[model samples]
Target: MKDTHKHQGLRNQLVKIISEKGITDKNVLNAIAAVPRHLFMDSGFVDFAYQDKAFPIAADQTISQPYTVAFQTQLLAIKPNQKILEIGTGSGYQTAVLIEIGAKVYTIERQLELFKKTKFFLPKLHYKPKKMVFGDGYKGLPEEAPFDGIIVTAGAPIVPNALLAQLKIGGKLVIPIGDEVQIMTLFVRNSEKDFEKHELGEFRFVPMLKEKN
Candidate 1:
């Protein structure tokens, strides 16, 4: 059974944090609240699951902060059953939240160890994504083109053209764009080859690098 109290505590903390930070999307909140974050982190760090902080996992990747997760999801403006693409799977925490929002998710993870670990934990957490690919995130999943929404967990110096090409017209993409410190970016496909870009705010995320393992 879902641990309602523990989950509720996390929800309450998220609401307080987002409200103070000016996040207004209730759907995003609901999704964040629904996913149990402790399941996504190391057992030693499970106690800090609800805190508004990023925590490290394997492969030098860290799960994004609660506010960032909620903020990015809000930017996507997800619709029920929308097909979504996630560039970095990491700990699969964001994917879990995306699934809670009813998105059919296709996530690509470059790190083999992280991918293998998550492949085990994801099913354990009941977050069986539509598809999981182990490949270079820069080259996205070409076979699964035309997504309704796309999210990149890692920060990149410039938005990859390939990822931009995968979005269907009217699709939304929320990514962090920069080399060092990134600004959260929202891209909406305006036409066949045009996009409307919105700079959300400054945020810090691990650099999006090709996985060595």
Candidate 2:
């Protein structure tokens, strides 16, 4: 529960490493520094929390690698107070990063165990999303439509049309698309029927399950 000076020093080293790797977004890097990522992992893995790697958590889910989180977040171009929808809450590390960056986030998780655990855990760290849901990521949060940005943390077979419809004009959706391996993809809503697509690079993520288990 305590974030010691040692933890802070480790986070600074991580920021420097990722910055050299081309993570130029200072806001994203600062958010990464502010969050106590060690608190989101199993105690046995805490020693590696700042290593920019992913580790297994409950429900067979892996907290996304820190570099991956920063990459997706940088693509979003998140602004303070922007309404952002996050798919896949995992260990809530990414959610904490989003909150630290000042986004009003609504996050959903399919795995009930993770959903329940994160819901109970985040607030204790004083990192809270606008809403935490137990539902299908493919469906998204339509009731909170027209988001400024939508970030999908898991890899999807294809981008969901529902997510497209939820984006406001000029908004962005950062998602990874593929099965065995994913191409980190971004879609910017240029108009009601127009989008600009860019494939950033390759990334591997747990598959985004269509239905909640």
Task: Please report, as a residue range, the 10-residue window in candidate 2 with the lowest summed lDDT.
Answer: 204-213
TM of each candidate vs. truth: 0.95, 0.98
User: Which candidate comes out best when scored by TM-score?
Assistant: 2
- RMSD in angstroms, all models? 1.6, 0.8
Q: Which candidate wins on lDDT?
A: 2
Clashing pairs in 2: none
- Model 1 superposed RMSD (Cα): 1.6
Which RMSD does model 2 reach against the true structure? Answer: 0.8
Model 1 lDDT tens row, 1-213: 356686787768877787689778877887777788877888889878888899999988899998999889988988889999999999999999899888999999999999899988898878899999998898888898999999999999989889999999999888899987899999999999889999988999999987565
For model 2, residues 1-213, the per-residue Cα lDDT tens digits are 699999999999999988888899999999998999999999999999999898999998898889999999999999999999999999999999999999999999999989999999999999989999999999999999889999999989999999999999999999999999999999999999999999998999999997735
